[model samples]
Target: MAVGLLFLVCAGAVLYSAEAQDPYSELPDYYKRGVDLALEQLNSHAGVHHHFRFLRSLDKSDIESGFGVRYLYHHFYLKPTRCAKGTTESNPQTCPFRNDRPLMDCAVCYKAAEDQIEPSPKPYVHCIQKPRLTQDMRTARTDHCKKMTYNSGAPTLLAVSTG
Candidate 1:
C-alpha cells in the first residue's frame, strides 16, 4: 500500500513539473485555441515582433460549460514604444512619442471599409493639439515593468479585469 501511494505521488509530481516547464502543454484544447487566436490578433494588429506572455487562465468555466468563449483578465504587455526602450528608468519623468503618426483605429477601420475607404471625417478639423513629449504621463508601475522582468522574462501583472 505504501509503495502504491508513493508511486502515485511521484507520478503527480512528474506531471506537475512537466506542465510547469511547458506552460501551454497542459492547457485545455479550447483554452489553447483562444490563446492562439488572441496571439494572432495581437501580432497582426500590434506588430509581428511584439512579445506576449500568458499570465494564467482568467476563467475557463465559460469554455468548459460550452458557452461561446471569452478570456477575461488574461494579462499581457502591449508592444512597448521606442521611447519606452530608450528610457533608462521605469519611472522616467518623460519619454518621446513616436515621430510618425501611429495607427490607432486604422486597422479595424480598414478591415471594415476595405476598398470603400472614405476620406478623413470631412473637413478634417483637428479637435485638440497633441500632447508635448515632455508631458508627465504617470504610467502604472506594473505597466512600466511588464516587459522589463528579471531573468525569468515574464512581466508581473499590472491590472486584471474581473469581467
Candidate 2:
C-alpha cells in the first residue's frame, strides 16, 4: 500500500512539473494582461457570440533591416458552434449578401501540370487554403501560367509564388 501511494504521488508531481513549463506564463505580466484585454474586446465586439481562443503570435522579420520595431502578432480561432447553417461557404463577398458575418476569409492555392508530358503525367492539381482579407484578389491563373511557361521552354508545372 505504501509503495502504491508513493508511485501515485510521484506520477502527480511529474505531471504538475510538465504543465508548469508554460511559455506563455514566462511572458511579462503586462503583455499577458494586454493579450487578455484584446481577446475580451474581440469577443465582445465581434458579431458572432462564441469563445474566441488564442491561436498564436508571430513577428515579421526583414533581413535587410537593422534593429527596427519588433512587431508581435496574435491570432485566434472560434470554438465550434451549433449554428452550422452555411458557415463553411462563408466569404467576405457572399457573407454580407447572405446577411452573415464571416468568421474568416477563404484563400485557395492551386497547382497544375501539363496534360501530355509522359514523365510529368497529366491533370496535376493541388490546393491550399488560407485566410482571406479585403485586399485579396481571387484571380484564376491557369492560363497565365501556361503563357509564362511556354516562353521559357521548360515545364511550367509548379506552384507559382504570389506576392
Candidate 3:
C-alpha cells in the first residue's frame, strides 16, 4: 500500500513539474484580467470570421517566413500584403504579379513550361494574378526553367529576412 501511494505521489509531482514549465499556462494576473475583459464582449452572437482559404494563405506565408506575418509582410511587400498576395521576382515587368515565385520564388518558368495560364485577372490586394500566356510563349519547359533560374535580385526579393 505504501509503495503504491509513493508511486502515485511521484507521478503527480512529475506531471506538475512538466506543466509548471510553461509560464503562460494560466497567464499572469494582468493578462487574466485583460482576457476576461476581452471575453466579456465576445458571445455566441459575435465572432471573428474569415474564410479558410484566406487564413490558410496567410498562414502559409507566415510559416514560410518563420516570423511574425506582419514583419515579413512589411519587409517583403513594402506594405504588408505581398507575402500572401504577390511580390515581383525580378523586374516588376516579367512575372510582375503577386505570389509569383514558387516557394520564395514561385515556379515561374515552371509555370510557363506547363501550359498557357488564364485570362484577364483583376487586381486583388497588392498584386494581380497573371493572365495565361499565349501558346507561343510557353513553347518549351526548358525555356521557362532558364528564366525561372534567373533571379534579378529585385529589392523585394533581396530585402532583409524578417524571420
lDDT of 2 by residue, 28-131 (tens): 44234334444444445545443332223331111111233111112222222333323434421122122233343222111212211122122112111224
State the C-alpha lDDT per candidate: 0.32, 0.32, 0.25
Point out where model 2 deviates above 4 Å.
Answer: 16-26, 29-34, 55-70, 75-163
Number of the top TM-score candidate = 2
lDDT of 3 by residue, 1-163 (tens): 9999999999999999885453223332322222222222221123312100111111111112222111112111111124222233443222212343222111111111112221212101122112443344433422432332212442231133323
Shift in Å, residue 70, candidate 1: 12
Candidate 1 lDDT, 51-143, residue by residue in tens:
333334423222111133222112221222334322335532223324344221100111002222223321111111123212232233223
Best-to-worst TM-score order? 2, 1, 3
TM-scores of the models, in the given order?
0.29, 0.30, 0.20
Residue-pair clashes, model 2: 1
Give the clash count for each candidate: 0, 1, 9
Q: For model 1, what is the error of residue 124's alpha carbon versus the real structure, in angstroms, after optimal superposition?
A: 32
Model 1 misplaced regions, further than 4 Å: 1-20, 63-163
Using alpha carbons, what is the TM-score of model 3?
Answer: 0.20
Model 1: which ten-residue window has the lowest total lDDT?
Answer: 104-113
